[model samples]
Target: MDAVVKKIIMEVKKGDQQAFAELVDLYKDKVYQISYRMLGNVHEAQDVSQEAFLRAYTNLDSYDMNRKFSTWLFRIATNLSIDRIRKKKPDFHLDDPVGGTEDLNYYSQIAADEELPEDKVVQYEMQEWIQNEISELPPKYRSAIILKYLEDLSLKEIGEILNLPVATVKTRIHRGREALRKRLRHS
Candidate 1:
């Protein structure tokens, strides 16, 4: 974490509303992306993301500064999303399969590097297809895949965020990618 972020978190822990707002602004998109990937619905993801931040704010006293703040926030967001998923009677319909638009923008930079226009189009299509396939994965696998790839978090960081062992996190990422590859191949 940056010195400024550490200072802000310390101040927020001490009840500084301005510092809390700054932290919120810094992390809101990350929280939203994780929630959105897990929930797969824009409205629900937004609500869950907001709730995660509120929960984090209320539980600031319990936060351990030794760990990354982003990981802690993501853990809250992931748990809230899981809770919401569990509460739904029909899980698939509730999930809504919203492919990640944020990821498309992130990959657009890479797509631009393709020399030929046809290759660029193919790259874009492949990315979209992969995103759709990933969204269809079971929630556990989906979360692991998103955190490892889209968020660019290390396996250890993912383990901390998801409260899993490092080996388990690596397993999930591997199996999830394999499943996605299988789905894409058969499609």
Candidate 2:
């Protein structure tokens, strides 16, 4: 962490609410994105993201300065998301047939510029299918896969973020990929 961030953390620890709020501002979107990918629910993602920040603020004393703050924050978010997933009955299954979807306007220009309409639709479908399969992974495996692939974190970094052995993280990612492959083959 930079000196300015270290100063912010210190200020928060000293009961400066604004400093804590600033920290939340910096990390909230990332936390929410991780939660959304892990849990596959918008409302729960919002809740988990808010709770993660709260926990981080409350548990500031336990934070080890020797570690990267981003890793620590992500750890908390992922744990919260995992716990949430474990507690809920899953709302959807990968085996279920998907319905048609709305176009993502952001992809519109790029897809139009680069490919024909049919190609864009197929591309979008494939992307959505992959996401669905990933969402169906076991919570532990799902978090590991998302951290490794979607967020593009190194295996070692993922292990650190999740407080798992490097070997364990590797295994989870491998299993998650195999699961996705099997699902795609069936589809």
- Which candidate tops TM-score? 2
Where does candidate 1 stray beyond 4 Å?
A: 91-132
- Writing each residue's lDDT as its tens digit, candidate 1 over 22-51 gives 998999988998888877667888999999
Judge candidate 2 at residue 60 and give its lDDT: 96
TM-score for candidate 1, please give it.
Answer: 0.77
Q: In model 2, what is the error at residue 88, expressed in angstroms?
A: 0.4
Per-model TM values vs. the true structure: 0.77, 0.78
Model 2 local distance difference test score = 0.83
Q: Clashes in model 2: which pairs?
A: none
Which 10 consecutive residues of model 1 have the lowest summed lDDT? 102-111
